[model samples]
Target: MLKFDHVSKVYKGGKKAVNDLNLEFNKGEFIVFIGPSGCGKTTTMKMINRLIEPSEGTIYINNEDIMKKDPVKLRREIGYVIQQIGLFPHMTIQENISLVLKLLKWPEEKRKARAKELLSLVDMTPDYLDRYPHELSGGQQQRIGVLRALAADQPLILMDEPFGALDPITRDSLQDEFKKLQKKLGKTIVFVTHDMDEALKLADKIVILRGGQLVQCGTPDEILREPANEFVEEFIGKERLVQAKPNITTVEQIMNPRPITIMSGQSLTEAITLMKQHRVDSLLVVDENHVLEGYIDVETIDQNRKKARLVGDVILPDTFAVEKNALVRDTIRQILKKGMKYVPVTDENNRLVGIVTRTSLVDIVYDSIWGDEAAAE
Candidate 1:
């Protein structure tokens, strides 16, 4: 619900911070602006809330020019968050979150209810409402900063490197948490970051900038698969480039669709027969409807042949499975980390659809490493 039409920001001595940028953001989009330092990504975002006013062209939020609106009123309608997480140390968490509501003259009880509700959104308990900012950890305080922004239930939120100051682990956690929160709340977010991985993970659309101008703007997959030019290619890095090859991105593209399976009610003798017939050591167990139940292996069948009658009685129900649409890279990571031989692929309803084996990943890994050079030879 935001549009930048030929927008530019020129500072004193006529140095343009943002150069005639034109972009439109849809409702409920998670848009990230990213580039090298001093590339004007921050300035572009600040101009949205009038933190830094644009020098040329027009910025419209919901078709209304921001310049015509009162600055304070406009800011209250849009949420702003920063890396420092400016939660007032003197104010209690409840007071900090309810600041906007109080400024709007909301009733005391209504404000408290709003504060409590906002706290719950971030997984904070109501008891935290009475505590001061210093009592919480950095991550908690940052979460509070986000909650305060959401406190007013605004449709648009501007975030300027909100997770940059935290440690890598905490930063990664917050990125995932915020991405999920954005999807659940469906708030239009304009996030600014220097980290490409973070932008790729969190953004619905990425706006890349260079020398205060729009270089390229596209979804992560689009930019990764086909970079606009050498500059964009260098910015995305060679490792990411190889990993995001369009042909082998998703599990569905590489997984074997016809995995050998045995019915859960089938006898252990039949399970062995099926495994031998497929020339495989293990078989995925499924119900009559093709819904995945678990798995049975030659070893398990051999060990329990005399004791267990049906495959269901000896089946191992803790098999790991990935959804068909999961990224192959992600599935590979999980497979390696868990030391899995193969992973079952399932649809949303957990019906067995395909399987990804370690053997299947060897070619992908080789291709990612050698790239087109190997194919050309």
Candidate 2:
């Protein structure tokens, strides 16, 4: 929806902040600008809404040059949110949020109604609308700041690290909430952040810049699997695959869902029979409840072949474990940390659902990047 065409910006002191940059932001695409502090990302963003006019080229919004439009009118159409939040201390939450509407000369009743709706949309309560900005938590205040920017009902929004100041947990929580809000109200967002992880998590298209120039722009997976250059590779690191997501991969998706099973009190012969029938190595015994009791692998059964003990008698609880919906990296890290062969997959209530062995993870990674048929070949 917005395009920066060969835009260049030089300050009065003759320092070049943005070097001839040509970029296009797709409609409703959550694009992120990331780089070292002096890389001109901030300058590039500000120039879009004419907060900082280009010294050379121009920017366009829907084929209309922004330089032609009145700055105040252009700003009203493009929401602006900065790191400081800049909430006016003198006004109540409702008053602060409704600042744009009031300025637009809307009726008092209309402004008040909009104030309530926008506040609620950002997940803040109506009761807080009467309260001052100082009365709310840092995160709450930041949320209010976002809501206020959104109140203008603009087609484009520029957010400059909206949650950069919060603690990790708070920042993560707000990012999640913001994601949901964006889905419900699909506005074109241009966000600037130093946090690569946050950018990876949220960006539909990530724009990397260095030394006042564009480096690369692509989807999260694209950057993760294939970085543009040596610098991009060194910057992103090998952890991108793991860092791109949190605990979301289903246990069943990465687990050996079907394992050889022996009855609660089955004999060693039964253990061997189950393993052979399933063409597997172990006999996993579970009671009627489906809770993981224990396992008797082929090695154990072979060692005690002459004894022929019941599966329960030979079962060992030491090898059992459960981690549900764990990230593949987390799963492998925990498994390697404990020096274990397999980890069970359980629901939130901790009942066994499946088992994730080292084999399962490798298979999953292989199947995902390369096709299943390709892997088979």
Candidate 3:
């Protein structure tokens, strides 16, 4: 949906911020632009909305040249998000989110409804609509920034390190959340980040830049498997290269085939006994046919013990799980990135087959990194 044709941006001096970038991004694709300082990733993204005008060549959005359009009107039709969040502290969350809609002269009731609908996408409650930006956490504020970008339902969005200021845990959560949202909405995104992990996790295609030029552009796996040059290889780092090796093992190979589990119909007393016997804080709840239902933990059981009887009554049904045939790398990313203790593995029928724990991953990672050399030694 976005194309960069022989694009070049040169400041007043002889410095070229972007040098002849020729690239095209497809619709609904998550495109990440990444590089070191002064590499022109941000400059390239800003040029999309005419925030930074190109000194040479043309940029087209769906075959319409962006430079030909009115800069202000073009910006309004596109979404832009920055690292600083840029939310007005005085404005309520609803007002902040609907800022663009208000500019479009949308009716008050329509704007309010839009804000509510957008907030629901991130699982935020309607009560937040009336609260000011200062009342929300930093992560929540960043979320608001994203919502503001999506306020007008723009087909293309530009994000310049939008999560750079957040803590690592919050950043990972937002990355996962935003990736899911992008898939659901199917908006073409041009994101700028220096973080390779973030680029790999979020981008459908990665555009790596250096010295104000495109060094390499490919999927994360492609770049990892066969880096174009020494610069690209070094930038990707050796650890990631090793981790992305071809013929990588699958989750089923490393997962524990028999995890501690209990029937949904089992009594709370029985659940407690099972937990104690297995020395586990929780037990996976499965049906008689071994289909995954959910899970019950010691804390959950204790909290509901007085009011609840069966394991099914207290089970938390929203447990994150993985398919048995999933790649080990993906499973590791899900568990480590989300900070989960373990992820249950299920078969095609949703039957509980196994579980992968953090400890198991640690061993597997060590082996992947040094097993051959260690064996030789």
Candidate 4:
């Protein structure tokens, strides 16, 4: 556990990074520090590991004052990953991954095994161990840097925008992977990012900083549902209120469940008719259990009418869809990417529970942003 008791940091020119901050991080808790650039998020993280000592106030790790501890020893016990990766070009991937283990004088055989295991954990092939840092892609190299930090088996991990440089798709995959790894290892993690979306997706708790001060600290749902102040709410944007969150929300909140269905044995014409009649873009094809077979789009029906095929011939299976409880934010993100107006939401039984159209999703987001006025209305 870590605690910041009235911590404050001022630079040589009297610039304050953090002001009278009081915070507590429970054991094995993953906390994210997020805000605009220069808001002292990184300053707070570095103070924990002693990369930058506070100008005033006390920082405690395990209830003991951190300032009294040896900086080098403290850093050795903390895993750190920065945005630039900073891997040594002369070192092979294996060496990079095992840097800490080697420094700790791990046995040659053990270091090799640890490096191999970690490389595989980060999705690097076994053959990659022999290659140098420059041989890998930016994303792969970033993974290596992160794996390197964890190689030492540290109790705390500090990550500052670790995935900021990667493409959106790669960043998303890495975020999911990090979540899995964290769940397995359960380290006390302090992550810093400017991205609200990333903070929401990965953080167990979010710490929002503004103008060198703590604004709010709470779980993702807590912060999203009840922002602490006008600044916090405005910073996160009122738009997130109705922002569709299908990943954790329900179809009933944003679905047109009664407007769409597909017959087990009907021509494309019937499917098209059903969609047009209901004013929906797609129809759900179901089996005896009301289990969803797939989705039949209006375009699919129209293009294949000459073949006398049933809805099953062109239904998009669950493989191409997401759960009904998926965050509507992510759902709308994907829809916007394809410039589509609809997404299917299914239940655990794989039944076509309901359909979420763009209009519905928009309404949710709109409501989230403007709910204050709506309540008054």
Candidate 5:
């Protein structure tokens, strides 16, 4: 429940970091600010907590102007997280997490309870309560930082790249955990990150900025499906644009559901016949359980037809395979690099699901970028 009216921030050197930004963050919605470096996304968020004052205009929280309120009192009502994971070295994990609660004059027992509760939310055991900041790993420390912000159950939270420092796997896991926590709590959150994928995944609404100016604001799907202009399109990047296209985000979305397959012990003649009937050059080879074993092409079959009677004798182990849930952009890159006509798609258990062909990818891209023009013609 925050609103910005004609907000602009100009520094001492007459440089504007934010230009006439007018926005409203709805209650219980996750809003993300995204753009390149020097785009003032951080500046925009900082202004909310009064860490950075705006040069002009007003910021309001629940119909009250923030500037008119005491900065310290205003900030106490809001939760804040930054990239640095700023935990005091001298404070124990429990103390650090309960810092905000303590400041609010919460009693010792309640603060301790809040600390334990927050730790459990992040999957940390209560034993961590006695540990210091240095005792935890980087990811653990960041988790504590997030917990600290939520320690007092503030109605609004501001996070500025809170997971940027962690490894990809850890960051991804935290993102999921944070999303769940946000939904469970229903707190209004303003998040700022340069990563488009993170914004697309997390934000209910995405606000794009460039050179300190509002470029576009909309839902992730809306922006992806229809960028405001060339700058907006380029900012979203080609890979994400592809992901935003209708029914083309993942390998499973484009994979041939019933790709021709032959059992391991099938005869070479049968493999050739299956290939001919399917009008394809290659056939996937599988075990009785339909688990992918390898593949055999017409050339391989022809070369070994005389000596190898069974398809298994000629099938070459599949070198390139992608999970069905993987991004289509990654599958496209592998296909292009390996000069493959199609790549095998497998389930999480490695059972063959289907195949993703180059043709499928090209068709999706074409329709996304130029399908409207072709339709007009």
Candidate 6:
């Protein structure tokens, strides 16, 4: 939906912000521009909405040169989000969100409805509508900022480090939520961030830059498997390559299949017997269809052994079940951080498919850095 044809941006002092960039952003795709400080990620993004004008070359949206369009009219047709959120403190949440719609002369009822609909998309409710920016938390305020961008329903959206200011947990949560929202809405988004993990997690295509030049542009898997050069490899970090491998490695690739399990209806005695036979401290508890319910461990059994006759009575909620298609490195990092012994691997339907343990992670690391033969040895 957007194209950059030999685009270059040089400041008045002759510092190049972007150097002969040639790229295309497809419709309904989440494209991320990521790099270190002074890498021109923000510059390239700003040029999309004319916040920064290009020094040379043409930018096209659906084959029409953007230079031909008036800046105000062009901006109104495209959504722009920034790191600061830029919400008006005096305005209510509803008014903040509906500002763009109101500018476009949308009916009052329509604007109000859009605000409510957008809030609902982010799991916020009508109760938040009358509240001011200060009334909400940082994360909530950022959500409102995103809602404001989507309120006008523009086909093309440009986000410049939209989640950069939030804490790590909130940033990750927002990234996941925004990714889902993008897929559902099918809007073409050009997102900028310096964080490589964010790009790996959220981008359909990643464009890596350095020194105001394009370093590599490809799918996360493609870049992970084969970086364009030493600079690209270094930027991705050797540790990230070993641990998370981005889109290239998945839990399914290393997970142990046919993990020992106990049915929810199983007796505590049976659960104890199973654990002893398997020499495991815990056994995954599953329904008849093998859907993961939770788990029962020796500790839980010992605590409730006399009080609980059934395993279900002592079953502890499953806290960590890695998705089968999740990146092995990312999954391993989470598991190790939480000090978990193992994690169940579940399919899209939440059916238990396999398991991953520290031992399995060792095998994966060995196989990743070395060869299968070396791992076997």
| The candidate that achieves the highest lDDT relative to the unseen native structure | 3
* lDDT ranking from best candidate downward: 3, 1, 5, 6, 4, 2
Error of 1 at 93 (Å): 1.6
- Superposed model 3: Cα runs more than 4 Å off: 264-285, 293-320, 325-327, 337-341, 348-350, 366-377
TM-score of each: 0.78, 0.71, 0.85, 0.84, 0.73, 0.92
TM-score of 5: 0.73
Off by over 4 Å in 4: 244-252, 259-320, 337-340, 365-377
Instruction: For candidate 5, write residues 1-377 as lDDT tens digits.
Output: 79999999999999999999999878999999999999999999999999999999999999899999999998999999989999999999999999988889999999998899888898889999999999989889999999999988899999999999998768877887999999999999999999887898789999999999999999988898899999999988887786566656788888888889999898988888888888999988889888999988999877887799998788899457889998775567557755888888999888999888877877777877788678799
Q: Residue-wise lDDT of candidate 2 within 1-377, one digit each (tens)?
A: 88888889899998989898988877888889998798999988898888889998879998899999999888888888889889999999999988988878889899899999987777677999899999998899999888888887887899998889887768877887987787778888999998877887788899999988889989876887678998787777655554333333556566777655666677888777767777778766777777777777888777877776788777867654656765565466556656777787777765677788878757655655665468499
As for candidate 5, its clashing pairs are: none
lDDT of 3 at 314: 93
Q: Is 3 or 6 the stronger prediction by lDDT? A: 3
State the local distance difference test value for candidate 6: 0.89
* Clash numbers, per candidate: 0, 0, 0, 20, 0, 1
Candidate 5 CA-lDDT value: 0.89
Better of 1 and 3 by lDDT: 3
* Candidate 4 residue lDDT tens string, 1-377: 88999999999998998999999989888899999999999999999888899999998888888889988878888899999999999988888888888877889899999999988787778899999988888888888988998998898899989999998878878887988888888888999999887888888999999988989999988888788898887777755644623233644566777646776667777877777787777777888777777667777667777874777777777534557777766666667755766766678877777777777866776665675578789
Ten consecutive residues with minimal summed lDDT in candidate 4?
241-250
| Colliding pairs, model 6 | 243-329
All candidates' lDDT scores? 0.90, 0.80, 0.91, 0.82, 0.89, 0.89
Question: Considering every candidate listed, which one attains the maximal TM-score?
Answer: 6
